[model samples]
Target: KTSLVVSYTTNGYPTEYIPTAFDNFSAVVSVDGKPVRLQLCDTAGQDEFDKLRPLCYTNTDIFLLCFSVVSPSSFQNVSEKWVPEIRCHCPKAPIILVGTQSDLREDVKVLIELDKCKEKPVSEEAAKLCAEEVKAASYIECSALTQKNLKEVFDAAIVAGIQYSDTQQQPKKSKSRTPDKMKNLSKSWWKKYCCFV
Candidate 1:
């Protein structure tokens, strides 16, 4: 996840790994001819941070639930853990299921490592099927190192986030919009938030 964020924001991979408990990054991009502030909250994914992670989910418009394509265990955790936790907290928010490390899926070294453990890289078909089972808004395979499909991943998130935000602001009543509703919409429309888990 760190590599993915760094690559997208900086167009290069991190030189070294640094453990993070919680961190946030922001980038402004023009989506549909309108400037959208993409606020990304990179939360800790370790088991020790499990109790504290959900606190960041509040008011999240969208989520990027990612796993390494070369790590089958991580892929399994997407359905067994991540999706359930996200659904419990933000049921209405859209999720873009991401399979990261795409560039390593066929690397000879990586394949040899997995073969020794009797495991194989998570296939794209399997990932898409899991997305369907989890009802994800969309599924994408990307390589931070190669910068492959990285832009499309965030593009999907922004589009989905905006759509979700619009739905939230829609008036509940069948009657015409009132002045109070318009005021609330104007005040909150500019605020868009997304989280990386």
Candidate 2:
């Protein structure tokens, strides 16, 4: 997850991997020549953090629901664990299913290990089906190591998020004219009377 965040934010491959249970990274991306501040929240998949993780879901515009393609169990968790958890907290938020570690999909070492366990890399077709099952807004396959389709993944995310936000944005309430009784009040008198703020 950090790899996804680091690669997108900095555009340089991140090394010396370190894991943080709950981390937030901020990045500004240009969408149509306007800067959109994006906050990427990375959460640990450990069982203990599950209880505390959903607190961040409130008012979230979009979610990147990621799974490792080479690890079938992780893919399973997308349905069994992640999607349900996100839906419970932020039901209406748009979700983009992300297939991570695409670089490892065909690596000999990774394939042999999966074969030992009688497992195979999750296929793109199956992943797309899973995305549809979860009603995801989009499905993206990307490799953080090689930076393949990495930018596109985030671009899709930001675009979906922006669209979601636009629909959810409450229409502005026009300001009413000040009451006649309050209109003539002196500035100093008003400040002294309403200084509670």
TM-score of each: 0.93, 0.86
lDDT of each: 0.91, 0.78
Per-candidate count of clashing residue pairs (backbone under 3 Å): 0, 0
lDDT of 1: 0.91
Pairs clashing within candidate 1: none
Residue range with the least summed lDDT across 10 consecutive positions in model 2: 188-197
Off by over 4 Å in 1: 173-184
Q: What local lDDT does model 1 show for residue 27?
A: 85
The TM-score, computed over Cα atoms with residue i paired to residue i, of candidate 2 is: 0.86
lDDT per residue for candidate 2 within 28-140, as digits (tens), equals: 76778866778777877888877888776765778888889999999999989998888887788888899999999999999999999999999999999999999998899
Task: Judge candidate 1 at residue 25 and give its lDDT.
Answer: 85
Over 136-190, each residue of candidate 1 has an lDDT whose tens digit, in order, gives: 9999999998999999998898899999999987778858877897887786766
